[model samples]
Target: MRNLLLKLSPFFLLLALFYHPVNAQNDSIKILSYNIWNGFDWGKDLDRKNKMTEWLKEVDADVIGFQELNDFTPEKLDAWAKEFGHEYSILLKEDGYPIGITSKQPIQLKTKMLGGLWHGMLHVKTYGIDFIVVHLSPHDWAFRRKEAEIISDYTQKSVLMEENSKLMVLGDFNSQSPFDVNYDAQNTFSLKRKQLSDSLRRAKNGPDAYQNLRFGSIDYSVISKFLSLPLIDVVQKKQADHNKKSFPTLVLGNNLSKSEFEKNQQRIDYILVSPNLENQLIHAEIINQGTPDILSDHYPVQATFKYIPGK
Candidate 1:
């Protein structure tokens, strides 16, 4: 009877352990991608700046990426990030294209793989978890191909070789999803694109293999295809809105007017992560879409994720 009681004791202890509150820590991360409308030669947006501040304050994300940065100085962006209690920022003002990233935790920049025209990779890790923040060009198709080549080259030569490095290419990629089959006539949610084909063309010559993920609506598949890395999109798993269009903002202030910006529609922003990191993705969203504050002309996109344990 005592032996039976002792065996039951272990089972009950296990149950009690599950019930403990101390084990509540999550392995996921909260990430935000904002094309903060800055630098563009529009009517100076003081009101919009305040709106941006308020919006960002409400977001409460762990990592943030901002685009269209011809105006905001690195010092100013750093100051703004500081307002959010963020300790790190990487803002550039070169070319019509500048991108920046801010994080509460320190990001170890893989400087070799980052910035030139496109922000390639900002490597960061928190508590044994690893990530690489990437911002791609948001241009027409032909130009996209050129940028894609650059990014693909950088990724192959740079990130894949790193030990345990989980890559995430998240930001505006300008090109539509026509290259992907997942979207109907309206190409919105697809991870795979023509870049996948381009990457495949070079795979045979590369040291490692690759996968093209346009097979799915989520960006994880695209990262899986391009980098040959293991990962998936967690937001799609918990949500049923598979057809949700990643409606990019219409550029309203410059040569692009309100109607011009509203005319064409597609999901330009993305979050393509390593395959192993997909299951950890918890949530993602497009911020302040309907309401336009002239922060550049595009809406900000953000994602939350957890670093899964034991595969």
Candidate 2:
């Protein structure tokens, strides 16, 4: 089917869509998505943020996508991010599931993807791409489809008409991908096809491939393509929400085995991203500052990106 589609869809293929650099000079930017496990721990909040600080110093990650802001407002988030040298932070208006965006550079509010129950999509225009850092719920695939549909309509003109406009929809896409589950009993559509759009599937090497998060070997840490607006994921680095190897064996227990870790553990965080500035790709991955005691249960994912590329 893939071969047939590749042949038939070649003409319809988004060949002209990968916007060429209209200008000889180009600027670069980096954006990151993370679930920071933020909460009101009262007196120990400073120490709680230590892992975040350590990761920022090491990874040099500029823009961050954060979930679980607890009760922190945008102002409070900014103040807290500042401890790690992050200059700006924006928390969405969602109740408990607030998502935050932090950057070393100034973040300008562009627009928002208003539909869907998964928090909200933060529309930010930078590096010639309309970047939307999202946090999708794991509740069900129906919500995921709604999220995709909303984004599709939002970028239809700019991204679909081969305008070279880029749109990146990334976050903790809570649901397992299509193939990750058997065919939904009621839905006749191929489980994978129903959830992720065609553009996302084609970004990588294979059709049946899913972002190899959690249970797998390290491959290219993304599903990116130059032509499409929702180009690809940044899984090319074998990245995850947090690192387990950084944990101490003693804390896990005296008698831990491979099966024990696999069953009891999971890398449940993500840092998926779209293409932008190469220099901004300083380093992206889970921050392992040793024990899980001081660190947020889920490590704060980090990446160092410059304000703009070639600056």
Candidate 3:
């Protein structure tokens, strides 16, 4: 019947294509976004990579978005995905660190540059859904904001064309929500501004001026842009109308030189979906569990959605 329809006409062929299901699963689907520090090599031990494999197996997500993958060859990642029971994979094959997407189901590549920005942005179609994986700028908020604008404009155009397609953008944004400023008046907001200002001055004053420099916030722009699109942030949406303190995806250790100089614990990782998929969202969370302890400075974030295969 499908072959016959294909021979009929282009219009009928389109109908025949639409009749087929877009995804394999008919029920719940799990997606995860993780920044494994410097790929799986952060700890400089093979055991760290082994632990990550075991952890991914345990999480059992159908799709995963990974960032900060250093020294990862296609063959290595392919072998890793096979261990996790995923047959499909794609990586941003380029210099410096890159991002990737791995899925249990088949996927087709859409875009890799997201308007030709730094770090990387990936677009893939799989599981009857569209996934955009990204690792935004980490050091400068201004750069991140610019990158976010590129993504926002591209997303707006893409979403308008296929309004009903389930879309998810997930990865290590290295950014935080501007709305959190409401609760960060004293600690988060003021301190970060001071630090940024000091750093700017230090740059002008030469190396000696950076002697007392400290890290500060610069991720607000990306989150703000996504929110403006009215995209549904899995965790944020779940916490709406409640005491909304976002769980920290990036955890710091006690090895810092001074307590005051320590960077604030914040959630810079996220999994956001289009507004159309809001109701399909089951739940989302940041995974920080382990027997000894989870490896990597950034925890993995997961989101579950009720599958609605494309007709």
Quote each prediction's TM-score: 0.64, 0.57, 0.78
lDDT of 1 by residue, 1-311 (tens): 99999989989999875431211357556776666654534327667776667767776667777666656676877887888767677764454556777777665554535444454444444333445455564422333455566666666567666665666666666544333334334332222344555366446646233323222222332333443433344333443343333444444434545543333344566666666566566676555355543454666666776644321
| After superposition, candidate 1 runs with Cα above 4 Å error | 1-27, 40-43, 93-95, 112-140, 178-243, 250-263, 288-296, 307-311
For candidate 1, the TM-score is: 0.64
lDDT value, candidate 3, whole model: 0.71
Worst 10 residues of 1 by lDDT: 209-218
Q: How far out, in Å, is residue 130 in model 3? A: 0.6
Q: Provide backbone clash counts, one per model.
A: 19, 19, 0
Global lDDT scores for all candidate models: 0.54, 0.49, 0.71
lDDT tens digits by residue: candidate 2, 23-139: 233333445555555453422576556655675556544466776677777677878788776766677764666776776656667765545656777776544445566666543
Candidate 3 lDDT score at position 159: 55
Which scores greater on lDDT, model 1 or model 2?
Answer: 1
Question: Per-residue CA lDDT of candidate 3, range 1-311, in tens?
Answer: 98876678898777765543323455788899888778756336687788878878887888999887787777777888999878789988745888888988788898878445768788989887889998886555666777888998887787536757678889877666665555444335335645877678668986455321224433366787988876778877664422333233223444443333223455678898888888888888766555213467777778888887752
Q: Per-residue lDDT for 233 in model 2? A: 33
User: If both were scored by lDDT, which would come out higher, candidate 2 or candidate 3?
Assistant: 3
- For model 2, the superposed segments whose C-alpha errors exceed 4 Å read 1-31, 38-46, 126-129, 157-167, 177-230, 237-258, 263-294, 299-311
Better of 1 and 2 by TM-score: 1
**Candidate 2 residue-wise lDDT at 273:** 40
> Which candidate number maximizes lDDT?
3
Report the error of model 3 at residue 55, Å: 1.0
